[model samples]
Target: MLLETSIGAVIRYKSPVSSKEPEFLILKNRRGSWGFPQGHKEHGESELETLKREVREETGIQFLEIMSFIGTIRYSYMKLNGIRSHKEVKFYFATTPIRDIVISYEHASYRWVSFLSGLNFLAHRQLKSILIKGHRTGLY
Candidate 1:
């Protein structure tokens, strides 16, 4: 079995004129599944560094303020080579003012949605729970 670790941000931003809460930025992968902007960690990189690089690479937004470390999620999946792999992802609460996003080729689309809408858009139970926790803790 192989273990991999990654880092990501639960990115949120406030609308200037809207009275609603800050919206979260979610990305839709080529497979049509929606989730946060994340990727695998590179060599000699810290978790925060990995998150910053991944977010910039995936979203094309460079400015961000990391608020807090949300938590970590773990799961297992089978690799293409018939190897079982365990993956761990550490998530951070981050904020940005840029609304327009330019996604990388890896994602099919992007959305800046409210907390509830984001929860509804996400298909993974673990990700939904992470959003719930971030909401309950008032990280947004």
Candidate 2:
């Protein structure tokens, strides 16, 4: 039995030139499911470091101020190799000033949407709950 862990951020930002309303950044993966930027942890990497690297790799935006640790979610899935793995993801509430997004090869597209919109776009119940927890943190 093997367990894997990943880290991610519920990134919030408001355009300095546009309206003051905050928007959450969501990425569309190649499978068409939408979620926040995240990736597996590397050797000797802290959760925050993994999150920052994942965000920078998945979305070109960087220099995010980590506000709070939202929470963690765990689930199990079968990989393509027919091995079952348990995965846990730790999410943080982060804010950034950059509005422009340059998606990486891991994702198909990206969107900066309102809180409600982000909740609607998220496919996983855990992720939706994470977004709501992030909202309560007042980071947005």
Candidate 3:
């Protein structure tokens, strides 16, 4: 059975954040939708390890450090067999590697948009809450 687990970061730059510069970086998918960079946990890897790996794989950058936890979200989706499986995703507030970046192929484009822009792109209401709370706390 595949129990899917993943992690994401709200990556912020070292520069003073601008309302126009966006507090969050979002990856645009093939579907024309946007989401955070995340990937599956590999064997023997810790959660943080997976988060870093996934972010780098998806966005071509590293996180200097994790500033805070943004909690987790879980939901279920069905496979071809019609048996539903659950995905639990952990999220964190992270600082970037102190360099500008380009994205990898998994995403067609990227945006460093404001919290409101990010919220507009994020498809899930629950993840939006996490992002909002993380922003309010100024965790990054």
Candidate 4:
């Protein structure tokens, strides 16, 4: 048996020099499924640092602040060789989107979607709930 863990954020921000509200950038994975930018936390990296780096690698934006801690979700599955494995993921609420944008090939595509559209884009119910709650709070 083995265990793995990751940290990421529902990062949001508005384009500078614009009057529009904040928007979130969600990535479509290699499998082309839409979701938040997240990846495994690397060794010797702080939680915030990992969050910052992972988001950058996936979406090319830098986080400005970690607004809130969104707790953790744990799940288990079998590895490729039939080994058992479990993972715990911690999410934080952060705002980014200041820099110019580009999508890395780690995902097939990306979108700067609105709060509601993000819910529609993401497939996971728990992740959707987090986005809805964040939208209601008007925190971007």
* Ten-residue region with minimum lDDT total, candidate 4: 13-22
Model 3 stretches astray by more than 4 angstroms: 16-22, 80-82, 97-99
Better of 2 and 4 by TM-score: 2
Best-matching candidate per TM-score: 1
Worst 10 residues of 2 by lDDT: 14-23
Candidate 1 segments whose C-alpha is farther than 4 A from its true place = none
How do the candidates rank by TM-score, highest first? 1, 2, 3, 4
Please, what are the lDDT tens digits per residue for candidate 1 over residues 20-108?
A: 67799999999999999988999999888999999999999889999999989999999999999999999999988889999999999
lDDT of 3: 0.78
| Candidate 4 stretches greater than 4 Å from native | 17-19, 136-138
In terms of TM-score, which candidate is stronger, 1 or 2?
1
Worst 10 residues of 3 by lDDT: 14-23
For model 4, how does the per-residue alpha-carbon lDDT over 1-140 read when each residue is reduced to its tens digit?
Answer: 78898887887764675678567878888886888877898999988898888887877775467888776777788988999899877888887656456778788887778787887899987778778777677655
Q: By TM-score, how accurate is candidate 2?
A: 0.94
Candidate maximizing lDDT = 1
lDDT of 2 by residue, 14-112 (tens): 567566668899999999999999899999999989999999988987788888899999999999999999999999888888888899998999998
After superposition, the stretches of candidate 2 with alpha carbons farther than 4 Å from their true spots are 17-19
Q: Kindly report the root-mean-square deviation of model 2 from the true structure over all alpha carbons.
A: 1.5
Better of 2 and 4 by lDDT: 2
